[model samples]
Target chain A: MMVPATSAAPQSGAHDKVPLLELEHLQMLFPARAAAFGGKRGHVHAVDDVSLALAEGETLGLVGESGCGKTTLARCAVRLLAPTAGKVRFRGADITSLGPRAMRPYRKHMQIVFQDPQGSLNPRKRVRQIIGAALELSAGGSGDDRLRMLLDQVGLNPEHANRFPHEFSGGQRQRIGVARALAVDPQLIVLDEPVSALDVSIQAQVVNLLDDLQDEFGLSYIFVAHDLSVVRHVSDRIAVMYLGKVVELSPAEELYRRPVHPYTLGLLGSIPIPDPVVSRSRPRQLPRGELPSPIDPPAGCRFHTRCPGATDICREVEPPLTLYPGGHEAACHHPLNVSSSDIAGAVRSPAASRSSGSVVPVPPGG
Target chain B: MTLRDTGTGHVPVNESAVGVLDVPAEPYAAGAATYRLALRRLRHNHRAIVFGSLFVLVVVLCLLAPVYARYIAHTGPNVQHITEVLDINGKSVDVVSLTGVPVGPTWHSRFFLGADADGRDLAVRLLYGGRTSLAIGVMATAITIVLATVLGLVAGYYGKWTDGVISRVFDIVWAYPALLLAIALGVSLATGGISIGPVQINSGSILIPTLVIGIVYVPYVARPIRGEVLALREREFVESARALGFSNFRIMASEILPNLTSTLIVFVPLQLAHSIILEAALSFLGAGVQPPAASWGTLLASGAPLFNVAPYLTLAPATMLVITCLGINVFGDGLREALDPRATVRTGY
Candidate 1:
């Protein structure tokens, strides 16, 4: 099942607009299985090599299952965690190893809204102090005016300032969280599972609010979530991550229409269609087996163990992320196509019929 | 409460298949601050009111101990009443009563509580006893709270070497029985009158018992608070505060301290009760308030030998001690309810 492509624009068509945030080969490994009796400690490879760039005013949706390093990647993207290795550039300035005091100036330009709305806001703090705290730190404008404006911008009652977080419902609490992030006037906001904790009915309201806020403030967002439809709703370009590495990156519509990697193909097949007539007619071809342990991950392609099209080449050699024309790219030795029998029986193939060389070297894009 | 989508027929018919809408939402709002909420809870607790009143009464009576001794009794606690103040039956106490034997209750006289073997008015001495006992408890509790808080904050906020060292030191102090430890300190520093470098403390000084009581309870206070601060360090709010670029000091004050306020309040009265009861036990063992400055503990000890004759001498001060300690304990239990931030309103919907 494929949604028709809406736009012809390539992902990297314009190079002049420098991305507000860039993460290069970022690696975050939780150090060691602790030794109870002084044995050798082993590293848990939480986030292996990951590289990404996010332009100003663009929302890059990152989709993956739990424990796939999506949350860790969001933290690394916002410079919340110093990566084990790799460069984090904020508008051409390196912030990877900056001291906390040195990172202060950059903090205003980047912010994060946590997953759980009620858990994220301090349970003891009133809404006014929660939002006004940032204002006090930045020391901008009159306190009351700024607080009322923030509350109003997030569609919360100005009188809500006196309320504690537990007094509000999930959606309303999330608005308070958004207001807090907006208080500093940040250019980039990394929203970690922003709507996963909400009711299905309330999820859309928060999504709409986020979309409208993005338009109003010209904010760049790295929306991390496990829901594909929610990601598709707000993102322009989508990055499909598996085991910390981005497996596929393309324009949102293009990736949904024709995903090259087998993992992305399996992911796209799993999104349920609402129409009963069409949904019952199609077969849901989900990937088999549990996600492999990151501590002792299968060698070569991290997805090879669960992948339906795992050839001998896939088990021995890791595939580099190769780009096709129109800014579509995937890291897979065997790209899913019409002839690939393992995918869904009614899978739609890409328009280009030529089966070129399997491996293509990539040039890093700005 | 579960949320329902606002629009049923408002959206275009073509877009009805998908569950998507841009409806405005009204968030829940209440205007009560944390302290306001806690104060409200405190007001509704009847136990807090009753016990707290009892404790206040005890404190006021202790504060007026000197006035009761001066005007009512007309004799200082250390003054020898002899035959002047005591009126037994219809006659004043003669030399026989003053010669180291306990006396019975006197009628319509300054020795309303009767006289001890020293011929001192037990009534005046009882009043002075309340002052010394309460003073030792209050001062020592203050010292224990301050030391525990500072050490706990330092150890918890900065772990590894600091936590390890402080924890080991606490373990060592906790290994010994608290009373035995207090007895050791009293024998060394209190028994012979403390003289350390520039500071000099006489054998009869209340400072000796105060120091002993304060140092003994440090481990108990520090252990629980250390556990709390360690937990607070891992809370998501602290991480969010750091992400917002607030300094560690600001985070500790604004994020950490407010959450810890209830825990701190609950410890105060509990620790105070413990200090007061401990001071009494130590004084009974000759480790507290020396001669000339008699607490309930020391006076009770002096009257133990003459129990067969004038049980009132020991009974009066003993009753005051029991009442004060029991009142403090009940009052402390109610304070816990008052300080608990999440205490539910149980009287009505």
Candidate 2:
């Protein structure tokens, strides 16, 4: 179900003009294995027709469960993994097809903050060496003042520069990782679950640090996360993905307030709200069945089997992303309204309405 | 910085405690912990300690070879050697000097193992031979490590054509048997007499053999270093270094090479032992150190014929050779185990 355009109010600001990064028709497909004797093979669409854009100083949150192609999308955005079929335009330049030598200059402009901080840093190197390596690689000036300033900026003492990664706490090591990423003075950073491996308390500290750094540097971030709450706070616009396709994309506040897609509404409702009274008062929509294997995703809509708003159309023909009134878009044959009414008449059968108290609206002008 | 604040308006500070009680910052430094862990791992192996001590003793003996020579000289000729005595048939009779011989018909007062076919004091030769063997082993291993490290670092870090060329070269060298090539080089040198000033030496001498042996084993040392470099190149720290704008050379040397120290330490002793053994085998085959220039291999070769009559000659040199190799092998094994991170934790290092 596509979001109705009336509900999505366009923002009035100069910020809408400049996009930091844009991806069009991003598709990464892996060759499928043949049968036991190589009889027949099918392609696995790991990432199919995914598109999103980030504005300067804006954090675009990409949230998906495992195997939803969230990580692959992130890697492709930073040019770590080549996209099989897509146009990755960074500042209006197509970089998807650039060779290694040609991509060197872009490497400085874009950086990635990996999920596993321990695996990311060299175990044998000192903190200063790890942070300073990026500077030395880009042929940046290496004055003592410059190095010290970076260390201080990351909230690490300059004197602790001589220490190796194994000597530091998980939080400190992650800070060092951030410092390394910042060394290149990158305009955009792809943070792949930066705080997923840290303690809850440490996660908050890191998230706050990231917010502060973003403001200070005017950097754009593609924050990939599994946690909805965390993504809501960091992201200006959040995209929810399922089975290699974006099921929903909307502004963070709007998406949380009134999610049009059944899958998205289910996700938000499943999250236990911090306020006990509001959580008990609010309606919760828990999805049934496990996420299907990506190798053989559903024929029509990948989430059709588990979607609460699934219909004959959702089972036979995939719904294209329809723009909602408030800039929200969702791919569902039948979508739920704020009052729990179906946007399509498919859910309005006497048998369907009698089975549940939820009112099913007739299709627009049906 | 102010040492103290005025008590009139500000909070009072402890003046005496400021300078006296200094809580050392960053007490858990990397150096102290790494060393501590290494020492802890090393302490668990009893055999390693014993062999390591023996290695130390051998090194000390080689260092004081001059002092040992003087002591032996003061003790006088202890072995009998057949030298410059005419026989009853009017020929130059071999009057065997029992004194200073390593092994002979009679035990000499000071000769521990007796003499060789040429009547050179075997005890004196053993000490001097050790000096040569140890020196060659160390020098060759050093050169091998240096060459291998540089090539490996370049190949693994740079990739592309650099990696391709270095890897191909290494593969070519690795395809050949190192010992066979070393022998061939030694034979070639022997055919072409090499001279330094007035001292002419055969190509089959220890000098040529050591040089050939060192060069042949360079690939062995290099391949491991290349593997290590490749693994380290992908590490986040290396990427961080790149992001920090570090030069490729700086990253390879400071960040990459330093991490490979444990691997190097383990490989060096094994390489040294192999070189020493190869040098001895070459000498025994008469393709290494020429006659009159004493070596453990030469001693064993001469002693082999007299094994039935006087076994001490062969026994003494063979025993020393075995002990030296064993000691080195044990130490190398200990170092390998100690350097392994998983082993370090289990062994309390």
Where's the lowest-lDDT run of ten residues in candidate 2 chain B? Answer: B11-20
Please give the CA lDDT of all the candidate structures: 0.76, 0.70
Question: Residue A292's C-alpha lDDT in candidate 2?
Answer: 86
Candidate 2 stretches greater than 4 Å from native: A1-18, A29-46, A136-141, A269-299, A305-318, A338-366, B1-32, B40-47, B63-112, B143-202, B205-234, B239-254, B286-293, B343-349
Error of 2 at B206 (Å): 4.0
Judging by TM-score against the true structure, name the best candidate. 1
The digit string of per-residue lDDT tens for model 1 on A186-241 reads 89999999999997766766777787788788888889998688888677889888
Q: Could you give candidate 2's per-residue lDDT for residues B1-349 as a string of tens digits? A: 1122223232112111212222242333343355566666788788898998888787787667556656752222223354634233354334344452333422332344455666555676777777777777787787788888899899989888999999999888888888777777777776686777998766555667667778888889888889888888887666545533356887788878877887888888899899888777877877766666666777777788868766877887787778888899998898888767677456643
Candidate 2 scores a C-alpha RMSD against the true structure in Å of 9.3
Candidate 1: tens digits of C-alpha lDDT, residues B147-193: 98778876886788999999999999999998899888877777698
Record all residue pairs in model 1 with backbone atoms less than 3 Å apart, i.e. clashing.
Answer: none
